[model samples]
Target: MLDIYEFSAVFPSGTEIYSQNVQHTIRSNRRTLGGSLFFDKLLAQLHVKSVSESRPPSANRGYLYPPSKDGNLEELHDKIVSAEIADHYKQSLLYYLLKDCTALDDEEAAETFAKKSHLSHKYWIVIQGLWNLDHLQFEAALEYLTHPSLLPAFPEDILRVLIDHGKLANKHLPLAYYNAVRPPLTNPDLQKSYVTYLAHLSLIQAYFFIETQPVQDHKSLFELLIDDALQHSRSDGSSNVVDELINLPLTAEQEAWFEEYLLEGKGRTYHAARDTVVARRLALGKYAEAIEAGQQLSGRRFNDINWDGIKDMVATSLGSRVEVDSVFNVAEI
Candidate 1:
């Protein structure tokens, strides 16, 4: 099995990949990798089933079955060899399946088999990365996982693992990995997690990232991005998250969505959120609605309101709207 020391020795800049305090952090979070979904995915890809009533009971069968610790390397090896799996996949499968084996020879056999099958070095990197991830060795995992030679397999899972297991200091590592790999984030859960992380980094960054996403996802994620800003603003008055959000120069559709989100959606929960709705309406020349929303804000955080910021937004909004309307009017003419 590839250890952190081996990884650091192999890579030229491995020693500098993480901070000096990371060893203490990793020790505090140490646990078995068997608990991760990555481990289950490895088993799932091999089509390893669990004990069931329909299947007859046998020692070999029980050993091959998941969530059952009653098997050994010999039985697992025999089962893998007999199965109809493709040859290329079999080597990696053997490596992982034999990883937890206590016997020293079994672990060596896995490495030897991988070599015999001529598994690509990148594949070995993936294995080591995932192995480190499993053991909560985050820094080492990042070093291996972010290697240029490997394809982005289980990208969403990799992110989830990093976010789920990593400490606060290691927060930037996930973003680093995301920037390096640029994984396609289609899963909503992964999207939320990544967005939350982005929000933690910067509200402006989050807004820009959300802007780049598919249109259909804009509403929920935009809503989430606002919610994050609101919460951060509420907690830390000097955070500037809200300040950044209001002055974002949102498109017409986004402006409408923002107004609706603040007025009717999760934004309603935060203090002074309606003030933004009022400022936006005033910016876009909706006097009646602006007055209406503004009236509701009276006696609530009156002195705390950012009238200057609102005025600035209105000035920028009027100019932008006039330009857009002028272009449309010319087309109509």
Candidate 2:
């Protein structure tokens, strides 16, 4: 057994090398095992050390039993002592000790090893949480991974897994997990995936969540959120989500971002995206700008209904539906 000092020298903390090694080792465990491969592998390593090393025959064996003199003993020896398995064993010893202690039915030896290893318990919890994910136990994974005590780590990787592989009944596991953990993702790809998921799940929630993000990221996430909403909306203007998005009480900065995204950014592909922006302007009581935008739009959802008629219709709808103090006073229009 390697001492804690030797282990620390081999795997320095807070390095990319250590993080990748832990991730690789956890992902290597076979998902088919009902119980932990950690315990079984540890037992095999102890058995190999007992037989191969020059230990005295009278040494305390603890829970290990002497193998019967049979062909099975040789086969087990050959399998556990292989170079590939031994290297993996070295990488996984710390991870295994952590898992064993956190298991529902704990092992005292594993706890003892964990104490001796002197690894951070938070790091151990994170690895165990990810191990649960590798096995497709999402609920159990979330319970530990999303706990308030744990600071976010490996956030983008975890988000990718949940978004790509979660098979919950509602298909909202990614959104749920993100809401609970709120990991600050720096990768553009993962940020796009996460916000796209959130937009499709709940436009209002996505809007509010975007409000809390960094101002630099707000425009991109908002643009993606609006593009996703527009893409999924029916051309005939039937999506309640579209209505919710258009009617959102946006801040002045958000309103400018929304207009720029639809009028000049990636939201231009959809036929009704511009018209949706005009409707939003109308909802925000920018009647003059709404009419100007309507005239500039090359494609309109209602080509036959003139801008004046559309304005009257929108004003009527807002008068009946919107609260006087919440949005704008209809009388002002």
Candidate 3:
């Protein structure tokens, strides 16, 4: 059990020696001295951080015997879907089993088993949504998530799976983005979930991967107009989309928006939002705004991009607004 692992963590340098010591102490004639209790408390203090692992039903999976690993997983799955046998803890067992199925890429069996609990079994419904999402069954996942009964218990998991699905997907980014990330931010029914911040992150991801229109003044400008574009500008990982966006002249609306966003950073938090607003300010030739935003960041965020070099560049461009007309070569910064 976890208590045993606690022992190993504390005595990692001499695990065998620690085990033998505990054993000898237990067997010694010192039982009157409370040696076992002392050793137990000593090891108990060394609790290792644990992530709970769901174990499968080893026997009696259903009306029939459980099959071997892959095939048995499918067989238990079949019984889990059977209405007559699905009444008790069978559904719960199926939820745990499906994780293994997903790990094994047993998509056909997992998907087919998942559909049986669509309208009922909120637990299985979430499990199925995760399984379907893993298999890239976006439509099924959206449909699976629509049950209303399934949202409250694990909204964060559902939200993350949807966002991840959209991230890896190519063709359905727009629909997947809307289906997965948008509702958690807007839906009154889900107003209590604390994942609104993650939804903001996902919203910008949608813009990068899918949302677009015919090139306007610049393709980067059009991309920047996607609402959440500024939310995660650092996400593009060397694409320079953020820099390209900064290089454009800020519209009255954009400047106002950047001002508003930077103001929301109470201090040293909302790092991504602060960085994007600073990048925009640097390009808009607003050295004051750049200096204020840069100063508000935590050391971690300030170091995210070289703020010293950037400060010098912005200071250099103060009166000139040089980057608006040229490439804004602040990559060194």
Candidate 4:
């Protein structure tokens, strides 16, 4: 039977010396189970004592098990004696241990430990944090994303990180994330916001790719836009045709057709067609043209179209909305 009193007495200096001695003993007698148990128990006691000294006075004030209570100390002592500190302090300690355990570099070891730790909720947090954008450990990210405990948090940050790092093109990343997290992402508002953000990013990417990339045929670009719109429509319950039209990329021919076939027609309805034309113009880096076209369209619908803003954004690359005007003239007119 381990004496808890004796263990508590060796705090300030005995702890370090005990650790060194334990390490030496473990090396010398690798096969001694009794020795291993004794060393682990002593080390656990030392750890509990250290934590006790450093803990804030306010901590555990309202908890059922207050740190300084005799009963809590006895519980710690019992855990140490049983060589089961791993079970008792697993969640709190594992979080610290896994902080630098790289998902890519230390994946196997980390995953093995995660399985053995028997603390799935805390383990999920560790895995998700490691897979975030700052880490960009794709292999690790995918591995953790597959974990049953880490589904929703996995897609949200990981996809955004990939997009920000340019590892995934704008069109694919959002859809991928949306798909990955959909089963778990139950909030309609969050779903709508994420889809809208993705749509915006896809439109920005399409504009840049079309203007600078010397596209031989418009098929891929059109497909990307249509797909993005479709995804948004699916996620948000919006009409697919409206979304497609609003996201279309207009060429000179399409612009001319809009003027003759749509805008000049007797029953001209400017809102939907104009929104699509403006969106296309914005996507083409044709700011002045966008502004002019936007102004010709009727209703307060074009009011939301920022023509001066778009004009200032002409020379900039896609997604760079640096332009600001006193007000959107199209909206006023």
Candidate 5:
């Protein structure tokens, strides 16, 4: 049995013409052309003709036939056909067709596709493309970055690269995307160690760009650092106090309190707090303070305090011990 479908085709003149299509064969029946294929071919021919006639008079226009549009139409038809054969084939064909579409870099393309396609799929494609771009195109990157669907998939490497390139104009991108995605830190120690590194990069970028001070999301940042310290802290070993404190934006009162705490008893204050404060200063490479603190901590009264043990922990935490000797008298402190 034949099925007929009808719709109105609108013209540039603001007039609509009613049209009907007849399907003459079933899926099981042999056919010259499937109903959908026939309609797709007709549409393609009409679109190509329309585009060809719209070009302005120019020498290059002769060679600029609408073949590109026709090719895309054919690709779309093949994708639809492949989708019916297998689920995997459908995904593959769709990915291939949409993967390299430079048109998607345009605003109209983003808007149209966002409205018509499954947003999740479009977001994945755009994010993948952005990751694959060697030199990021800011506009294209922004298109995907701003897409609500894409934010959750933004990769950490891309975020790092963006910060390195000095393009993270808005601090909120990292704040928002990290909160949403929260990529697992593979190496907890390494990740914890780099908090200051990332923060310093962000600070430098902020200074260079003259951007506003980052909103001090101190609660979250400090929580992360505290967790890191607790995770890596050994009861017998010196604490990685510097890693915990350096990234923290201390208030004047807090800084003053630390200063007083470290300097209280004719330098005996630092000796008493050596295990805690020296461990921290060493983590931050505050070598001079570490030497002074270590000397006081290593005095005859505190000889059993294990100065070598403390130094070894600091070296391991910092990934190098070369500067440890310069900071303290190895024989005495």
Candidate 6:
């Protein structure tokens, strides 16, 4: 029942108090691998079914009625996803909300929360992406990373995370979509390539950026750009391919120089670093790591792969072993 003002006003130390209470309450519950034993019981008491449940008919559904519960998960969920929910509800309030109620059945809520978070410096999308990625929801994680609302504001690190996972997940989806979807990602914030931009000087550079957008239902513009970059680098006469990104034949010296001069931190739009992540991870049989990487540069989503009701096939293929890091690609960076 806490409003935005009261939630925001809570002292940081209040987290410790909440933790203590949760620990005290859960200490007596039967524990499981995810440490959600007590929390699940609390949710059950509220008659909120788990996301994994195979819902039955209304007449026979046990979830339709459970004891004398009056709490409405739908209403709470509505509040969680409502764009007008609370302008000031971000950060600690959100963290605590998620920590207490991990029963997020709405995927859009996570994306909207990330997009609407007030702080520009903080990556709300990443927080949700890593959480989803950990749970083997690869497509969901990728959506948070590449959500159109986040595209303009996405940082180099987030882009790297996308590339790291996207490259491998490419073949996992249908051919039509494999190339069709990406955040136009051609934002002013990202540093475009010298060969593409500097091919001319001032305005022609701007023209090139404007003219060629990633067409929907076509291969991702970045993937096409990577191909063209390698083609252009052939004239550089440098045979020394970056060993990590050896799969992609871009000259190491040129890309390093470009990243140094053109980029603020990492590869902005066209990053060889992303290519390296995909190449190295795949070559090493890091299926777990690659899947955790999220989307292929092709812009194909994790869910696009035909699961056919096998929700955790990717996880099962790896015998349920998942990466320890919230993001698999972040470690190499």
Best candidate according to TM-score? 1
List residue ranges in candidate 3 displaced over 4 A. 1-66, 69-131, 134-136, 146-153, 162-166, 171-240, 244-282, 286-333
What is the TM-score of each predicted model, taking all chains together?
0.67, 0.56, 0.30, 0.31, 0.30, 0.25
* Sliding window of 10 residues with minimal summed lDDT for model 6: 64-73
Where does candidate 2 stray beyond 4 Å?
1-127, 167-170, 234-238, 296-333
Please write out the lDDT profile of model 5 over residues 137-167, one tens digit for every residue. 4334544554555533335544454443314
lDDT of 6: 0.36
Highest-scoring model, lDDT: 1
Worst 10 residues of 5 by lDDT: 2-11
Q: Which stretches of candidate 1 lie over 4 Å from their true place?
A: 1-35, 49-71, 97-117, 167-169, 236-238, 278-292, 302-333
For candidate 1, the 10 contiguous residues with the lowest summed lDDT are 3-12
Choose 5 or 6, whichever is better by TM-score: 5
Give model 4's TM-score versus the native structure.
0.31
What is candidate 2's lDDT per residue for 1-333, written digit by digit as tens?
A: 435324333323321221333333433442333222333434554444424242333322211122222232333334343435444343344454335324424434345554555546765566567667655677677777887789875666667777766634247778767878877877878778877777777888888877777788888888878877877676445467788788887888888888887888877767777778778877777865765576555423433444445655655755632332223222221
lDDT of every predicted structure (CA atoms): 0.61, 0.58, 0.41, 0.42, 0.39, 0.36
Q: What CA RMSD would you report for each candidate?
A: 11.3, 12.9, 17.4, 17.0, 18.7, 23.2
TM-score: the better of candidates 1 and 4: 1
Stronger candidate by TM-score (4 vs 5): 4
Ranking by lDDT: 1, 2, 4, 3, 5, 6
After the best TM-score superposition of candidate 6, give how far the Cα of residue 139 lies from its true spot, in angstroms. Answer: 1.1
lDDT of 6 by residue, 231-331 (tens): 44445533233331233333454344333322333343443434444444444566555554433333322112222112144455566534322223222
Model 3 scores a TM of 0.30
